[model samples]
Target chain A: MVAQSTGADAKNPIQVIERMMKLLDVLSYYHDPVSLKQLALETGLHPSTAHRILAAMGATGFVERGEPGSYQLGIRLLELGNLVKSRINIRDSALPLMQRLHQEIGESVNLGVRQGDEIVYVERTSSGRSSVRVVHLVGARAPLHVTAVGKLFLLEDGLPALREYAKRTGLPGLTPNSLTSLPALSRELDKVRRHGVAFDNEEIEQGLRCIAAPIRDDSGDLVAGLSVSAPAERHSANWAPLVKQTADDISAAIGYVKPDQPAARR
Target chain B: MVAQSTGADAKNPIQVIERMMKLLDVLSYYHDPVSLKQLALETGLHPSTAHRILAAMGATGFVERGEPGSYQLGIRLLELGNLVKSRINIRDSALPLMQRLHQEIGESVNLGVRQGDEIVYVERTSSGRSSVRVVHLVGARAPLHVTAVGKLFLLEDGLPALREYAKRTGLPGLTPNSLTSLPALSRELDKVRRHGVAFDNEEIEQGLRCIAAPIRDDSGDLVAGLSVSAPAERHSANWAPLVKQTADDISAAIGYVKPDQPAARR
Candidate 1:
């Protein structure tokens, strides 16, 4: 009887799976909780069908029922996400250092990695006192051409790849200070490579400034970047050395020894 | 060939889906990263078949390939987990208060909800300095007969259901202090109901003491329980009032009001 409504194509397994995945996609769009009726309306499925799909998802721990009829993604996903994140040693190793840096600097610190054309924040730590001022949550993504961490990640990819990426994604001006030309960004990246740090002078938000440095893997391959964000007034020119020192400490913690360092540094 | 191996039952759609789900189950067993060869060996599948399943999972964002042949759960899962945790508002609303309580009491604070016959911790905050400990992680489950939160949830389910549950599961002693007899636990539950609080005096772990209070929803239905864990040394006679204040703050935050409250209390 369940198959009665379908004509010739009713039993296609891939289509069934696709429909289920689409239902999950609809549920994932809302950052807040969503009701089954809202899911039904959004997915253009009958309410009963949406309820059935959600029930199936709940059974598999893919979704959890919220207050009554509402639902949200479940902790089974966190178990999986943690597995992926644990392999990224840079993120894991940098976390404690990031926490210490945030405490010392009284600012927010983030670890970002390039994923496709965007930079994804893999980790973040904020001092408990200043946490309210820094609203960027972990897992949020930002454009590669704007933030300090983004620019540091881009610089790590080197000039040729950076040029192609900028050309493809377009170097649009996010703020008055944003580097909108390929030449200017290339020059900035050179400075970043030489100094081993990048700066964001209110390029993302007017009152926010950041300093970032790359984190390299055992092979000296650029793996990720770390950055500290503070209000512009607090990020005076004198703070650069302090930020660089914190970044170096984090880099050393992750086994990135500077070429000039003695072997005893390990 | 794929169809021939399934014999006459080859056309059963649910069996095919179950096979796919079984692959996921095999994947879930590895908390540490898993290699493709290990996965294939564990699942008793041909390497090609395991690879195919993993590839399909990767395409759907359920799993991701780690270094070379290793595979891990993806960020997509974490995104979903965060969504579920957000919808389970008791965890979010109670976490800050739990942290503050932990800071004040210099111990561990836990938030848990009844799931089937067990209690699953939804949130936990701890004072890093504490030597007395509890192993309650988010998504970790504990037996209902032993834990303070578990007993609170069991008591919240009322007398008849409690009798049925205890009859089915039996009150097993986790530690010497744990209530093992049905009559003894029932009496304890009664006491807890009258006082609006519960205590675990080394019932779960020796030398550890905990005080717990139930949390309720706007409908006045018991939703979860909050608890503070401290060393017996710190849980001296005078600690009850401080624990009660923390519990009342959390309960009030979650929309629970005392039954005898004046009309202006809201």
Candidate 2:
């Protein structure tokens, strides 16, 4: 299935595909168009090899010639990316990331979304090794002042709206640690705003604590929350960074971009 | 079997890249996992050839084996697509599509976004052969009731909000044909709701008309408008479908999916 070393790759081996991926990886590293020489050096492919492959990809729009001899990643990747983003379910997208986090921490990871005033558990992954189980089963619900994810949605509502929410919901509590007063809820939400994450502090159950981070969509609007639930003794602040990262990864899977990008926000 | 490339592409093209593209195209065509037999049949590739390539792509996550030997498009495309979508600007994304629409219709194409109560023209392409040039400059602004793009924003506001908008603006008129009354604005918005398109009918200037369709983001929220502006004599209902399609295309570039898919609406 091999042709002359320069001709049709319709039958080329996995090695060619790996070389193509390396070239793509290098192209993505440069913010501007990259020179053929630099691309070849970065990928460790011969200049002629890089040139021929780049030209082939150019034909298929995997790369585009920019500013003469330099090249940039093409719009074709974005087009394909959009198709993938649109076809995937958020729950399905979040599960693997959640599983990775769970396997790392040996704790339960939960994905929740705001439904009315309550945060509804949409998906979760857990390591069976935990001695104390947390009740983050699928379809469970908790009020805004109690769960870490609920507190995030409250903060997103802003202060005045948060005050109104407190008035409406009467700052309900599931346990002694819950923020049952408007002042307590207000202070906790302010911390949520400052830290860009929220904590349940054993509010949803007697001995279980949770740490949650916001998950946003393309327009930078918070659409869901990613959190880790564990026994209060086992839960640590160290979980915050990983939970936040996994949440961000899920958001990116759904087409989110930070405002600093040229894509900007809606 | 491989892609039906012409003789022009037969010489010195990367065969693996061509085969990879063909496999991706075939994978994207089906909503579910495609068997080795079906993929081979679809791409005219041998089953062994298809399996090996799919295996390679799976290693890179561009394809995933689903339910044994059957294959489906992988999340790697989504990951790369997110990278592209997040980095691209709306104006940058819209211009190429706008130029294509202009070339097809031989008229001016415009991209506009709502600012306060007005739609400010953000980008445009014109054939230069127009008998009269339209003032769709980069920063041109028009009231929500007087321009095709503007009416779309008004329609998105719904009836109660539209009523408030009419009250707030007093239904200002720039031309005799403008929708100056609440009843008129309401009726026009109703048509916009029904047809999912809007019109100006020379309301902004004498003999100049425009047709606009809504542009939404990945969340299905209206973010901008895409339209065709030309002399009233040349404007027709036929432009509606193209304008709508182009807007939808731009939406797709930014990670939009129609409601029929499993991704569902937020």
Candidate 3:
């Protein structure tokens, strides 16, 4: 399908679908109701051709008439979009990239999300070295404060939320090194917020450490976290930038747009 | 445009758009790769015509050629769907239903969503009566445990989350009847979870009480809450069902489907 862009934009395209799509493109570009003349001008379609196509699309609720000779994108697009959003599996988009990252770092690359106060691991790719533990736990849940990815969520929730989380969970300790007090956790969260990455230093278990970065949605909401986990002897803070980069790669794979960057459009 | 549906299916449709959409519908309907014969049969188009159109659409990434003659829906729909999802405003769909609910209940109907620890009012329609105290707070943020709509979000977050919320906010008191402890909030949330509705009995402000129901999106995720706020003296528990119904109506407007019900399609 990708090879026919030239044909699609030629005077004739898909017999009629491309013309209809061109009209839709115009409708999507304009936030306000667009006049027939304006739409035809934008798409290089004859007014009669554009009108006929718009009327045909309007029948299917793909385009909506606003006032006389004017139209807007229709509600049907929203319905289809909602269906697509529901169907999109983040794990599907992240899997190949997770495999790539696992190969790059030679460690377990994992993806996890919050379920209540626990971060549930949804996907993982291992180093195959098998020296470090923690494998085959696809549906495992861990406390939010004890894992590197969990801390990204805590930072996302902000300081007051961290204080509340500590107060409520009593900052239960999984290890002696786990920061179980409000101040300590708050300080850790500060670094996570500053660096846009987090770490679990023998926190969840002995001799295991991890570094994680947040994965966001197109809405800029934190949807998941990507982490590189390894044995304490093998891990380093130097992996921070690479972990963050892979997380960003997964974020882009799953349609997240950084606020500083302009969103790409079709 | 709708009246032309009959013509669309008779033999030819829109010069080619409908037939292409028919192919798309079949592709979308099938979860796996569809053979050329199957699509041609499904859409009543000749194999050559189907192949030609599929080739054209394949060039545009709207359809992907799979093994040999097999085809599947492509990634372009996801990109377009994401665009549509971002552009959709809940306020646009909710306002009309909120107005209808306001007209029925003679009270202020409001829409809200959680923003961190606060429930921000996004859209609303007030009864013609002048008894309500809160209005015109489109971007205002209030503590999640205080507003009627806020309770729905708390309920959505579940009990342990509710416990954390109580511990975090200390169930801050804004009025004499405001819930100020975990036990009271737990009991309140139970009723909300059971009845699928929540209330604010002069909790945010004296003399202003509210009844609320959760509004979910396509994935059954509670995206917002719909509420009717009125003077405490005039409020009634009997309004719960109507409020819930209106919330469901708005949920449907924004493409939320009930888990037990089959989704409607084009």
Candidate 4:
């Protein structure tokens, strides 16, 4: 039915809805309050159009007016986000093991899941004594080709899907070491498949490194990634086995059984 | 400008937005998927009106169609939630100290802030070894009078505001020990003001108990609450001094200085 409505329909409700979504997408990119003019410019909508949509959204608590004409994503979204996070039981199940890993390694440990072309950090244990802050904050995101957790998901996607992803995102680079070529990223994913680990060596941010292992669900499908992140100077390949073991432990708790290893480590 | 519209007009974009918000509000109340028929019935909108709004929302990824006819809140909300959660710098400043408190007390530690009539848990450190589950998950919300952190907010609201709150919420009781009477609640707030700590003695849950201390900002405004939670049997009043110290430590980290304490602890 929606497909049937074509041509110049300025008063179309669907077009208004589309414009509303574009405004929200723009707001999601900003951490601070944004003015109506900025939002209008970013979305390519007229100032009056943006203002009307924003006012409607404000009434619904999806957008909040701040200093005069500036607006922000509302608390209602936080309420909804909490509901979504709570529904995903993997976060609760993996957090204990993530804590244990943080205690042992004295480095930041993160749990992330794939959301489209990005990876979202759903849970994390911070490196307490480090003066330098770890960049993999909970709820933080990075492109699939740049983050260790992201590569685990990319490895699950075959060469064709990965190539398509590269084309779609243009392989945006975050640091000097980020893989900007299809061949380079493909080779990295190959290692991830064989070694059961992925690395972000000063990739997403300078001086930071991450080692990630895949988390499996009851059906032995990759569900999430558990990554141990540290400064590049302190990162070691020695942590791979321990990280893999912890990921395996979380997978087991979620009813995943290794097809090859009859007696998996608990 | 929105106040100019009074009577219903079919072509009015604001009325359509109101219907859209009504659908979302209904969806928020459910943890499981809801059918279109049920949503229409709950919102008192025609099925066609609800369907049109839901389809628009689904396009924007705010709602997801599940199990053919059922719908659930989408991951886009989760993405936006992460954005909002990460933007709040207090969660970052309080976390390391909360981790320290959790280590010292061997219980779950939480950070919460007031949002309208409820308190939202912004950050928490799980008690790793405990079998008992902590109910205050990140992004979770509860009524102002029901949580230990919430009571600290009430203590700041003064007598008149507290009375208005009681009348507004009807002092809804969750357990036998809940403060359902206005006088009883006032007395509890009085104690909280004097002692600088608030206790939830099985107020929200039967076996769970929480003790909370107020977190202040640079302007000396009460900004958030820091709480330690444990089972009723394991809870101790001795943790009060330690909790207060940690709350004060976090306050100091955020540039808050008490007028009485000239030397703030680093």
Check candidate 1 and list the clashing pairs. Answer: A77-B77
Instruction: Give me candidate 2's TM-score against the actual structure.
Output: 0.73
The sequence of per-residue lDDT tens digits that candidate 3 reaches over residues A83-128 is 4445556898788888887777788889999998999999988546
Model 2: per-residue lDDT, tens digit, B140-183? 88888899898898888888988888889998788888879998
Q: Which lDDT tens digits does candidate 4 get at residues B157-202? A: 9999999999999999999999999999999999999999999999
Local error of candidate 4 at B86, Å? 1.2
Docking quality of model 3: it rates as: incorrect
lDDT of 3 by residue, B1-266 (tens): 23223332433336476667677777766666799999888777889888888887776656677587898765555555555555557888789888888778887788898898899988877444655445426787889888888988888888888888888878889888888888888898888888889998888888888899998875578899898887778888899999999889888766576665433234
Name the candidate, 1 or 2, with the larger DockQ value.
2
DockQ of 4: 0.17
How do these models rank on lDDT, best leading?
4, 2, 3, 1
Tens-digit lDDT track for model 4 on A167-191?
A: 9999999899999999999999999
Instruction: Please provide TM-scores, in order, for all candidate models, with all chains considered together.
Output: 0.36, 0.73, 0.63, 0.40
For model 1, the local distance difference test gives: 0.69
State in Å the error of residue B154, model 4.
Answer: 19
Deviation (Å) of B18 in candidate 1 = 4.6
lDDT of 1 by residue, B1-266 (tens): 45333223323334333344445656655555689898777656777867766665665556667587888665455444434434456777788888887777777788888889988888888556777565677788878878878888888778888889888988777888988888988998887878777888888777787788877753357888887776776775455566667767766554444555411110
Cα RMSD (Å) per model?
21.4, 6.6, 8.1, 22.2
The candidate that achieves the highest TM-score relative to the unseen native structure: 2
Write down the lDDT that model 2 would get.
0.79
Location of the lowest summed lDDT over 10 successive residues in candidate 4 chain A: A1-10
lDDT of the candidates, in the order given: 0.69, 0.79, 0.77, 0.82
Candidate 3 colliding pairs: A1-B58, A1-B59, A1-B60, A2-B59, A59-B1
